[model samples]
Target: MTVESRRLDGNAAAGRLADVFAFDATVARTRCGGCGTTAPLGAHHVYADAPGMVVRCLVCEAVVLRIVRTPGHTWLDMSGTAALDIPDGDPS
Candidate 1:
């Protein structure tokens, strides 16, 4: 699908990510493995309407991040990102 119709932003994944990350995961920077694009998670497009969360690259329209929350656990996958640079911080 076109990125616009299927994309939101990292803000939409805040709540679900709180349980997994101590800091604002959106602020972290990552490089898209598909197109060698780099941007903060906040700048990436996010899709939350599905059964889980899907973050895609704004430039390449490729999957950059995905999260699935099950009843017992949350599954997070960042395979589409070539590199992730999550700064150290405590947003609490």
Candidate 2:
């Protein structure tokens, strides 16, 4: 399928991510290992129709994050992310 038809903006994954992260994970910035493009996690591409969620880089289309949930566990893999900056929720 075409990438456009297979993906949505990362905001769609926020609810699922909230179960794992205490903060709003979508606001976090991530650097792509494949292209070095840095942007907010919510700005990336997300595919949620699969068995799990697949987050891809905005520039290189590389897999930046993956999360799979089973009856007893949640698996998270971020091997394609070079860096991640999560906001501390500070007003500053």
Candidate 3:
């Protein structure tokens, strides 16, 4: 007879959650609307229908940019632009 078992500790579980919630760095970028600074944006899990997400400025914590994940690619919508640029690969 043979027995096999698998176990996951708290850190392991947390790591998995982090992996699931992790965002792609290549498709993430935002500009602060309040501070007018450009920097890498943070990924936030909000409602499903939200147009996009607000990226906070590293210096000021202001919303620098908005990114939206669509059917094909991730769109980076600037502060004053109505058009969105679709990046390669799955945004989510």
* Winning model by lDDT: 2
TM-score, one value per model: 0.84, 0.90, 0.30
- Which of 2 and 3 is ahead in TM-score? 2
lDDT of each: 0.85, 0.91, 0.38
For this target, which candidate reaches the highest TM-score against the unseen true structure?
2
lDDT of 2 by residue, 1-92 (tens): 88688689999889888989988989999999999999999999999988889999988889999999999999999899999898789887
Q: Where does the lowest 10-residue lDDT sum fall in candidate 1? A: 2-11
User: Native-vs-model 1 lDDT?
Assistant: 0.85
| Candidate 1 lDDT tens digits, 1-92 | 87567667777777877789887878889899999988888888888888888988989879998899899988999899899888977669
| Pairs in steric clash, model 3 | 31-64, 31-65, 32-64
Candidate closer to the true structure by TM-score (higher is better), 1 or 3: 1
**What is the model-wide C-alpha lDDT for candidate 3?**
0.38
